[model samples]
Target: MADEIKIQEIVEFLLKHGDGYDADEAREAAKQSIEEGQPVVETMCLQMLAEHVLARIHDPSWIISRANEPDCEDSELLKRLLDSGASAADLALFARMSQREYLSNLGCILDGAGLYDTPSLPHEEFRIFAVNDEDQPTAMIDELHESLGFSGLETEMELSRQAERDSDNAGS
Candidate 1:
């Protein structure tokens, strides 16, 4: 199929780049992975290629700059979630965080799988949201303070809540 040929081509190109792999070895590995029905070999080939690419990232700015592109925006699903479920106070907590805190928060969020050895993902239709397993939002927020060093976030969330309560009472 076209996909198989494309993958073999990528493997050949990466191996030819002298990452301790020769063109002949790439051909043999690619053949086994494609013609011999050993798909896992292709996975190894791609992982080897990824390692070489990741090792070349000498500057964090390269990643930061690319992340600013519109392609990196939260998908339409998340935009809707914020519109419907998220509150002004929630947005305030995020908007007020320092740059360091923002990146730290993103790192913590991205690596959140650390707590689970094997996490069950939802169906594609529900993939935009975390699979809710009967957890309250407040409890999960509290847990993040301990798990991700988000004590400052926890405090900010509290202040936001109190201010909202004050405004509500004043409006009455």
Candidate 2:
């Protein structure tokens, strides 16, 4: 059987480097692990550190639909529904309903609400899975893939740059 995994070491490593990767701490951890005959522990700690950094760098919104514009197709459908006599409760239901059910009832829901002119608004499913897998000490990549709900996903790496750009755009 494999050596028992060290939870305290992993937690300490995560707490020390979860906000960002620290080369010195990583090196020290590796050195200590080697001295203590725990090479596997060192490898696990490094892998976890990399995954934590990746998750922090990527924007969660990149996986979701952009906010709908007021005059966009969906909003127009909503407007037409309101005009045709759909109650606020109906729209609220539409907003909260599952994507599959919402699409299935789209036409009837709109028509019954008095909206005949507007086209059907397309819906996309967005799932965000944040997992802390307990089976492996260095399961960061697995957790990230599970959280992202996709395999081999590409993500922007410059979060700070993106934030700066967003602030600039907002100010202008």
Candidate 3:
């Protein structure tokens, strides 16, 4: 039996550090793919191992469409907080302790109500991986492939990244 956690780790490694990498996204894709139970997701992992490991080239198709989901629910008080003169810090604290129950492990909520664009992480920096298979590419893939192996299969790394919500602030 393949260790599902290990597969998630491999999926994350390829997306975060592999050829056409996005340092920010790999984690979420790791969780989603496992829960999603989609073959395309697995195929994506295979593709990443097969190609990016060998050739550091990017396929335009690799730029996939993803939903721009808010990491957490904005505080019911978010508007009030903003209205009352909460510093970004106040907002962050409120969000951390309260609002972000869903993706609490991912991080606290930093953007909400689309009032302004938050393009970066502030003050604290955090990076986490449920597993660290990043050190050895061939070894990691070899181990996973032999057990849950699929050879000669073309696939894409079913990775995902959360981008800021509409800058135009549409649908506010």
Candidate 4:
């Protein structure tokens, strides 16, 4: 019961302040929650860490500074950049050319990179039904992704497909 309360408090805190809170602050909060016996808090902390890393990766100035460091090996820098959402082409350009040249060619590199095909993750969507009028059998079917503030259209389609499969299996 105590653990449940702590988890609920953590969830409420995240829902209330997640957007406004920096990754470090969120991480600290998650840590405190963990120390309070909330094992699930680690998941939130990991998410915050990923967000912090991605934010750093997306900052152009940070990327430039890291790229310009002479002591840093190109492979190490490339790996970090990739993990942060840098395209493979960008890393290739960075490896082979001077920073100035790389910057000058960035647009072209991106355009050319777009020509290569890449596999995308499959989308899944799920819905929750809230029945407001039981007599009329009317329900509000909320897409799971939308309720979670996710970009839901693709996920909804995927989930709908999965639900169909599950229903078919159940019928069989």
Ten-residue segment with the worst summed lDDT in candidate 2? 123-132
lDDT by residue for model 3 (43-72), tens: 555555544433422321211111122332
User: What would the per-residue lDDT of candidate 2 be over residues 84-170, giving only the tens digit for each residue?
Assistant: 887555555444344334333442442234234445544221112222354223322245335534232123235557878988999
TM-score preference between candidates 2 and 4, better one: 4
The CA lDDT of each predicted structure is 0.51, 0.45, 0.41, 0.52
Kindly report which residue stretches of model 4 are placed more than 4 angstroms away from their true locations once superposed.
Answer: 1-4, 17-40, 75-172
Candidate 1 least-lDDT 10 residues: 135-144
Question: Sorted on TM-score, highest at the top, how do the candidates line up?
Answer: 4, 1, 2, 3
Clashing pairs in 2: 129-147
Hey, what RMSD does candidate 4 come out at? 18.5
What's the candidate order when arranged by decreasing lDDT? 4, 1, 2, 3
lDDT of 1: 0.51
Error of 3 at 59 (Å): 18
- Cα error, candidate 3, residue 10 (Å): 2.9
Q: C-alpha displacement of 146 in model 4, angstroms? A: 39
Error of 3 at 13 (Å): 3.4
The Cα RMSD in angstroms, rounded to one decimal, for candidate 3 relative to the true structure is: 21.1
Give lDDT: candidate 4, residue 20. 71
Predicted model with the maximum lDDT: 4
lDDT score of residue 64 within candidate 4: 56
Give the better candidate number (1 or 4) by TM-score. 4
What TM-scores do the predictions have? 0.24, 0.22, 0.21, 0.29
